[model samples]
Target chain A: MNEYTYPIIAGITVGTALRVFMLRTDYRQYPTYLHGKIIHLSLGFIAAALGTIAIPSIMEKEFTAVTFLTLAASQFREVRNMERNTLTEMDSYELVPRGNTYIEGIAVAFESRNYLVIFTSFVVTLCYLAINGWAALGAAFVCFVISSLLMSGSKLSDIVTVELSELSFKGAGLYVDNIYIMNIGLPERQDEILKYGMGFILTPKSFSVRSTIANLGQRQAILHDVSVTLGVFRDSGTPALVPLIKRDLNDGRIGVFILPQEKDPVRAKEIISSVPVLENAIQMPSRKRNREG
Target chain B: MKMEKAILAAITTQSEKVTGSTAVFHCETKEEMEAVAANLEAILDGIAHALSDRLYIIVKH
Candidate 1:
C-alpha cells in the first residue's frame, strides 16, 4: 500500500464512525430532516473511501489535494446545512414570553482546531509528496484526532437553549416570526429565561410601564397618576421624617401609579407628610419596603 | 403534555421565519420539555469536554 493509502483508510474509518454516532444518538432531539442527513453523511464516507481507493495518480501531490478538497467541501456543506436548519427551527418560536411559552437562541462557534487540522492535512499531503511518503499518512491520523476532538468539543456547547415556563399560562404559544438573535449574550442565561421566563414587548412611549407590568405579572395594584415620596435611608439611622419626594410617581403603594412626568416637589412633599407609613400602604407593602427602614 | 406539544408545534412552524433554520421537535409537556432539556444539557457538556480536549491537542501541537 502506498503512503496515501493508510491515511485515506484512516480518514474513512474515523469519518464513518462519526457519521454512525450522529445517526444513532438521539435523532429525536434533532428535527425530522436530520434523519436524511444522517444517511447522507454515511453515504459521503463511502464515497470518500471509494474515491481514494479507485483514483490512481503518479504525482501523489495532485491526488492528495483533490481528495482533501473534496472531503473538506462535503463536510463544510454538512455543517452549513445543519446550522441553517437549526436557525430555521429557532425561528418558529415566539421568543418573547406572553403567557407560559418561552424561547431562546443557541450560539454555536466554529472550532478553530478543525481549521487547524484542515490546514495540517493540506500541509501533510504536500509533505508526503516530498520527503517521507509515509509521513503524510501519520499527519492525516493526527488531523483526524484533532478534528474529532474539535467536532466533539466546545462547538457543541454553543447550541442555543429555548424554553417555555408554566405550560398552562394563557397565550403561551409559539409564534412563527421570532428568530434567534446571535452573538448577543451568554446562551446559558438566555436558556434560563427561556425555560422559566416571562416577557412583554412595548412601544417606545410605554416601554418602562410595560416592563413594570411584565415584571409584576397579574399582581394586584392600583394605578395612579400622582407622585409619591421615596426615602433612601442608611441602614443604621432612622429615616428622615421628611422623605425625599418625587412627584407623579406610580409607586405601587398608592396603587399602580404611572407618573407621566417628574412629580411636583410641593405636591410630593404634601402627600408624604399626610400619608401614614403603616396605615394606607397596601398589604405586605412593609415586607416590600427596605428592611433597614 | 398536550399544551407543551402545541407550543412546540407552534414554535416549529414559526421557527423557519424567526431563526432561518429548520425547527426540530417540540416539547409538548413539562416532562417532555424536561427530558429534552436534560438531553441537551448532556450534549452541551459532552461538547464542552470535547472542545477542551481539542484545545489541549492544539496547544500540544
Candidate 2:
C-alpha cells in the first residue's frame, strides 16, 4: 500500500514484543493466569498501535493525531488501578499478605511498562520514517536495553546485609539477635514456634538506608516474599505462629522472625536479600541532612 | 469505634491479680489456667499473653 505501511507494522511488532518481554511472570507470579496474560497482551497491542500511528500522522501533516497520546496516558492509568484492585483483593487470602506498598509498587510498574512500550514504538517508527528499516531495528534494541535498566530497582542486598540470627526465648518474649519480637504465653505454642521458626538480622549498610529498611511496608514485603518462596508454616486459626519484624532501637538493625516450612537458612537468606526494595517505601533522609549542613 | 485489641478474658490462678471489665476465669492451678487460656485463644482467635506466673490474658490483636 503506502510507504508508511511497512514501518508501522515493524514498529507495532517491536513494541508488542517489548511488552511481552516485560510482562514476564517471575517469582511474583502476577499476570500468570491465561485471562490476565490475555488482558495485558491486548492492552500492549493497543499501546503499540497508538505509538506507531503517531509518526505517520505527523509526517502527513495531521498534527492533531498526536493528541491521542493523552488518551493513552489515562488508559495506562486505568491499568494501574486494575492491577491495584486485583492484587488488593487477592492479598487478604494470602498466607502472608503483600502489604499496600508492595501492591502499589507493582501497579506502578505495570503502568510504566505500557508507557515504555509506547516510547519504544514511537522511536522505532520515527527511525523508519526518517532513515531506514535497519536503523529502526537498532533503535528498538537500544530501547529494550534502556527499558530493562529502568525497570530494575535496587534490591535489599544493595542497601543491607542479611545475616542469620539465633531465635531464642527470653522468658515469654521471642528474641531475634537481641530484638524482642513478641510474647507467646503458651508453652505448646512456644514449642511449635521454636521448632519451626527462623531468625535473621538485617544490618543497614549506610545511615540513610537505616530508615528505608525500617519502613513497615518494606518489612512486610520481605515476609511476604519469603513466605511465598519458602512456604509459611501457619494457618488462619494460629495467630501466634506468625512472622514478625522488630527493630533494635539501639542500632538500626532489624530482626526478621519467620515460620517457614522449608528450613533452609541459605535459601531463606538468599530470598530475603533478593526482595525488591519497594519504591514507595524508599526514604533518603541523608540527602536533606546534607543540604542543611 | 472498632476495637483492634481488647482483653477478651483473663485466665488466672490468682483471681485477686486481675479485676474489672473483662471476664476472669479463676483456676485452681497453673496447668489448669494454661489449658483454659489455650482453648479460649483458639476459640476467640486471640493471643495468650502471660502477665505473670499466675496470670494469662487472651488479647485480641
Candidate 3:
C-alpha cells in the first residue's frame, strides 16, 4: 500500500472505532433504528476523514482545505441540538423521565464524542506521519483508552455518603431518619408507601457537597435516574406517587423518598451513589466565605 | 385515624365554614404534605363510595 494511504486508513479506522465505542445502547434504547445509528456513524466517519486529511493537506501546503475543520465545528453544534430535541420529545412519554439537566448532559456528551473522534484521528495521523503505521496504531489505542477513562466524571459517592435509611410512617407522616419526608394521612396509602417505598439519606461530606445536592435540578436528576433504574409506582395524574428528594434545611442533608414498582434498597442506593455531580450544582460556600474573609 | 378519614371529617364537620376557600394544612416538611394528600384521597374515595358527587380540587404547596 502507498505510504500516504496507510496514514489515512489508520486515522479513519481508529477514529471511527473510538466514536462507536462511545455510542451506547442502554436501558433507554436511545438513537434507535437506521436514522439514529446512520447519521452519527456517517458524521463520525466524516469527522475522522477530515482529521486524517488535514495532516496531508498541510504537508502539501494546501492551507485552504483546513477551513473545512471550522465548518465541521459549526455542524457538530447542531448534533447537540439534534440530541437535545430528540430526548426532549421522548422525555414526555417516560415513566421516569430524565430531567432537563440530565438531558443536557446527554446532548453535550453526543456532541463531544464527535470531537473526540476527530482528536483521535488527528493523533493517529500525526503519529503515522512521524513513525511507522504499526507504532502509530499502538499509540492511538493507548490514546483511546486514556480518553475513555477521562470521560468518566466524578460520581456522587466522591462528594457525599449515600446510606439506606429506614422508610417509616408516623400516622400519616413519613420519616427517613428524622428528616420528615412527608405525611400520608390515608392509612391505605401509608400502608402501600411503607410496603413499596424506599428511602436514602445523602450525607454530604462538606459544605460544597451539601450545596451541590441542594440544587433542585440535581435532586430531580437523581429521582429521574432512580425511577428509570427501578421503575416508578405512579401512573399519570398520580402526583403524590412521584419520588421526592427533600433537603434538610438545618444541615443540608438530602432525603430521597421513592416508591418504585420493585422495592430494591440496594439498587436504589447504588443508582443514587453513581449519579453524576452536575456541573452547575457544585457550590463552594465555605470556600467563597473563606476567600471573602 | 387515616389521612383520608381525617380530611373527610375536617371537610364534613366544617362544610358551613369552609364555603369555597381551600382548607390549607401546613406541615413544616414534606411528610406533612404527603399525609395531607393521603388523607384527602381517602376522604374522596369514601365520598365516592357513599354515592355523593361533591367534588373538591386537591392541590399541594
The C-alpha stretches of model 2 lying farther than 4 A from their native spots are none
lDDT, candidate 3, A82-160, per-residue tens? 9999999999998667778778888888888888888889889988998878788787888788778867788899999
Residue B42's lDDT within candidate 3 is 46
Interface RMSD of each: 18.4, 0.5, 9.2
Model 1: residues with Cα > 4 Å off, grouped in runs:
A1-7, A19-28, A31-34, A43-75, A78-82, A86-145, A152-293, B1-61
Candidate 2 per-residue lDDT, tens place, B1-61, comes to: 9988898999999877788999899999989999999999999999999988889999888
Winner by TM-score between candidate 3 and candidate 1? 3
Query: Which candidate has the top score in lDDT?
Result: 2
Candidate 1 chain A: 10-residue stretch with minimal lDDT: A97-106
lDDT of each: 0.32, 0.94, 0.76
Expressed as tens digits, the lDDT of each residue in A1-293 for candidate 2 is 88999999999999999999998988888988999999999999999999999999998999999999999999999999999999999999998999999999999999999999999999999999999999999999999999999999999999999999999988888999899999999999999988999999999999989899889999999999999999999998778888999999887999999999999999999999999999988999999988999
Instruction: Give the best candidate by TM-score.
Output: 2
Q: What share of the true interface contacts does candidate 2 keep?
A: 0.66
- Per-residue lDDT tens digits for candidate 1, residues A1-293, read 86666555544554454344334323112324766555545554654454334323435335554555566656655554555465456544412111111111111222122234345434454445555656756765665576556544321012111121121111222211131111101233234324432221111122222223222211111111122122211121111101111112232111121121343434433332232111111123234355656
DockQ of 1: 0.01
TM-score of each: 0.28, 0.98, 0.83
lDDT of 1: 0.32
**Decoy 3 TM-score against native:** 0.83
